[model samples]
Each structure stands twice: as structure tokens, then as C-alpha cells.
Target: MKKWLTIALFIFSSSVLFAQKSVKMHPVIDTAKAKWGKIKIVNGTAMTSSNDIVENINLSKDYSLLVTAIEDAGLTQTFKSKGPITFFAPTNQAFSKLPAGEMDTLLKPSHKYDLNYLITYHAIAGKLTVKDIQRKINANKGEATFRTIAGVILTAKIDVNRNIILIDENGGESVISNFDIQQSNGIMHIVSSVLVPKTKVL
Candidate 1:
């Protein structure tokens, strides 16, 4: 009788410990839900999978360059932090558009400012959805100026057909191909081409 009681007590304690560990090990899903809500615009196709934003991006090959650049810039912690940042994430092709050998140079540890500025320039503070962008354009009479975190003002416009367009200082323009990629801390908008700052327009 004594042996049976001891075994039952041990099993109960073990079960409780396992249950606590399981709860603690659950994946973070709040961020995923926030992303879904933030990116309902530009279509939430990406959010249709698991409700884990980081997990979703990790599973995506299309965002490889963006991921790599973020890692190179040491911005993983910043992006993962408690933010509602709006990221204008460039695709692999966008990075490829960089001048020959420039990408490698920028990725070097010595060129931290260039890489940091380039990445931060693509980000805007706060959580801006596609509708918010459209509304801003309409409020500004079809055009608005957005100041990036890097202190550069970018021109935003909507055409007569309601397509969103961004014009850099160098008279170059790129359309926001994918809008409203929601994340826990912020949102992401995918652009087709890379955005080179006016200072780096050469």
C-alpha cells in the first residue's frame, strides 16, 4: 500500500510539471494575430497561414533578401521588439538592383551607417495600413509626404486609378507591390524595386 501511494504521488507531480512546461512552450501567437489585423489591406494572403508572423516569414523564400539584410544590419532585435513599424521590405530582386558590387560592400560590417540608413529609410514609425495610406493621400489632395525614421521625406501619391506610388527625391518612383504585411510590432509593405536615397543616388 505504501509503495503504491508513493508511485501515485510521483506520477501526479510529474504530470503537473509536464503540463506547466507545455503551457510555457506554446508558440507566441499574439504577434501573428496583430499582424493579420494590421495587414488586412494589400490582401492578407501571407497571414492566411499560421498566425505566427515570424514563423510565416521564416517559412517564406520570397523574403529571403529582406531577412538577410535585416540580419546583416543587426535589426532583428529591433524589428522583433514591441513596435508597430511599417516596413517597406524590398524583395530579393530589389536588392539585386543595387549597383554591381554595391550590395556586397553595403553588407560589410564597416558600412554600418549605409546599411542602417538604407534599412531605416524603408521603415516608417507607427502602424499604417493601406487604408491609412490612401486616406493620407486623399487628405493631401492625392499626394502626401512621409518622413522615414532616417529623417528623409518620401513622396507618396495615388493615381487617378487609385494605385499607390512612392516617389523618391531623385525623381525615381516605385509602386507598393504588396501592402499591409501585418506583424506584432509593425507592418511590412513589399516593394518591387530598391529605393536608393537621393544622397546615394549615384
Candidate 2:
């Protein structure tokens, strides 16, 4: 085990040196460094699935309502595109918790843009595993803020039970039920409630 760990450490060091040397040649890596500082080595399972975000969602029975919402909002293609998105997926039970008629109304073609905004509010630009979030929370003195794809902020904090809780812009709270479900494009964490943006809070 000691030998294996030493070998892993050597490989990690080599990779970091290579990344530093090639930063100038890779504009995307340079931009990432500029925004997020040094590369963070998050310990987790590798995401080697050939399935994209949409396909992964389709495989899950829990995401049926989310699938419908994606289809209704015409975001199927968008979610399938190449991305390292972090999606906070709410299950069918979460959608059922919404006020009656709200889902139906949002599904209407006239409310397509509104539905799109609501769904996209649950997504972040890059993959952030539970460990990454916990690290950010610890660094930020118990709370970490992340901007969603809809340009709204979501705050993450550790609850009394030590579960990661996401607080929407409108102060709605959703506990992460399951996390670090890896996909080809990114990762997904299942939430216990649908997060409503400040503008669309019911």
C-alpha cells in the first residue's frame, strides 16, 4: 500500500508539472486557473461513462419528472451537449411537492421560457462533487455560494445532521439526498426539494 501511494504521489506531481508547463498552450486550462486558482485534486470515482447528462437522467427512474420538464422546456439537446455541468436534480417526489397546477402551468408553451429558467437554476457550470462543496463550505466559514446556470446564487452549508443543504436565492432549502453520480459530461447530485429562484419563488 505504501509503495502504491508513493507511485500515485509521483504521478500526481508529474501531472501538475506538465499542467503548469502546458498552461500557456491550453487557453481553457489557463482560464480555469485564473478563475479557480490552482487545480484541486478531488478524491472520487472516475467519470468514464459514455452516456451524456440527458442519457444518464433517462436511465434513472427517479428523474422521470425532471425528464418531462427537460422535454417540455426543450432543453434535451442543451443538456446532451458537451459540458462539465453540475446538476442538482430533484426527484419525482420533489416535483409533486410543488403547489398544485404550477407544474402544469409551467409546462405550457407560453411558459416555456419560465420553465427553462427554473430548471436551469438547478445547474452549475462545472462539476462540483460533495467533497468539493464541503471543502468550499469549510473555507468559507460554514457556507459556500455557487452561481447557477440561470445566473442565480445557491448557498451550500452543512446541516446539523452533517448533510449538505442547498439554499436557493429565495431562501428555500433542499438537502442533497444522493451525490457524486458521475456522467460523461459531468456529475449529478439528487436533492430533496426543487429549488425555486428568487424571481419565481412561489
Best by TM-score: 2
Candidate 2, which segments miss by more than 4 Å at Cα? 1-48, 200-202
- Candidate lDDT scores, in order, read 0.74, 0.84
Q: Please provide, for model 2 over 5-64, each residue's C-alpha lDDT reduced to its tens digit, 9 standing for 90 to 100.
A: 999999999999999988767778667656544332212322225667787667657678
TM-score, candidate number 2: 0.74
TM-score to native of every candidate shown: 0.71, 0.74
RMSD of each: 9.5, 12.8
Q: Which ten residues in a row have the lowest lDDT in candidate 2?
A: 39-48
Clashing pairs in 2: none
Off by over 4 Å in 1: 1-56, 200-202
